[model samples]
Target: MAKTNAEKQKLYRENLLKNKSKYDQMRKISRIRDNKRKKVERINNKQSSSYKSHQSFGKTVKRVLQSLPKDIHKCVSVVHHIAQEFNIIPKTTSHHQREQHSLSIELKQLVMNFYSQDDISYHLREAHQLFLIEHDHTDAYLSLGSFSDLRPS
Candidate 1:
C-alpha cells in the first residue's frame, strides 16, 4: 500500500508538469497574435492618414483653380508647379526668395488687371496679415512694435 501511494504521487506530478507546459505555449502564441494585430492596426492608421492629407490637398488645388479667370485658367498648371516648389524650398534660401518674388509679381499683375490700385493694396495687406497669423508669427510681428503702424484699419 505504501509503494502504490508513492507511484500515484509521482504520476500526479508528471501530469501537472505536462499541463503547465501546454499553458505556457498557449500564452506565448496569444501574445504573438496580439502583437501582430497591433502592428496591422498601426499600418492601417498611417495609410488612412496619408490618404486624407492627399484628398485635402487635391480639394485645395481645385478651389484655387476654380477661383481664377477663364482667360487665365490655363495657368493652373503653373500655379500647381509653384505650389509644389514652395513646399520643397526652405523659406530662408535664395531659391525660395526667387519663387516668392515670382509669385508676388504674378499675383500683382493678375490683381491689377481686374482691380484698382487701392483694392490691390488692401488685398495684399490682408494677405500678409493672414500669412503671419497662419504661420503663428503674429506675436513676433507684434513684438517689433511697428505692426500697428503697418497694419490696415
Candidate 2:
C-alpha cells in the first residue's frame, strides 16, 4: 500500500510539471484582458477633456467662416477678435492677409520645433531669438511660446 501511494504522488508531480506551460498561457491571457480594460478606461478619461478637435488655426478659422451666412459681419467680427487675440495681428484686408500671416507663422513654428535642447546651446538660442525679433516674427515666436510656455533661451 505504501509503494502504491508513493507511485501515485510521483505521477501527480509529473502531471503538474507537464501542465506548467498551460498555466503560463492562462496567466498571459488574463494579463492581456486586464491591460485591455485599463487602456479603455484611459481612453475614456482622455475623451472627457476639452481638446476634442485636432486642427490647425487656419482650418479652425475656415470652419468658423463657413458655418456663418456669407452676408453677416457680426460673425466675421467674432472671428477677427479671435484672430487678433491669437496675435495674428489682424488688419484691414485681413480676410486675405490673415491666411498669409497665419501660414507664415505656422511654417516658422515648424522650424522652431525642429530645434531641441539637446542640439541647441544658450548662445545659438539667443541668436535665433534675436533674428526672429528682427524679422518681425516676435508675435509668431510669442504665439509659439503660448503653445508650450516656452521662453527665450
lDDT of candidates 1 onward, in order:
0.55, 0.61
The candidate 1 region of ten consecutive residues with least summed lDDT is: 137-146
lDDT of 2 by residue, 71-153 (tens): 66877777777778888975564345433333355645544564544565544546455445545644553444443333234
Residue pairs with backbone atoms closer than 3 Å in model 2 (clashes): none
lDDT of 2 at 96: 56
Which pairs of residues collide in candidate 1? none
Provide the clashing-pair count of each candidate structure. 0, 0
Model 1, global lDDT: 0.55
The residue ranges of model 1 lying beyond 4 angstroms of the native Cα positions read: 1-28, 37-45, 48-65, 68-73, 87-153
Candidate 1: tens digits of C-alpha lDDT, residues 1-153: 356888998886677668988767767898999999999998886653444577787898799778765765557656656767788533333334442212244433433342343444543546445434544622332222233233344
Task: Score candidate 2 by TM-score against the native.
Answer: 0.22
Which has the greatest lDDT?
A: 2
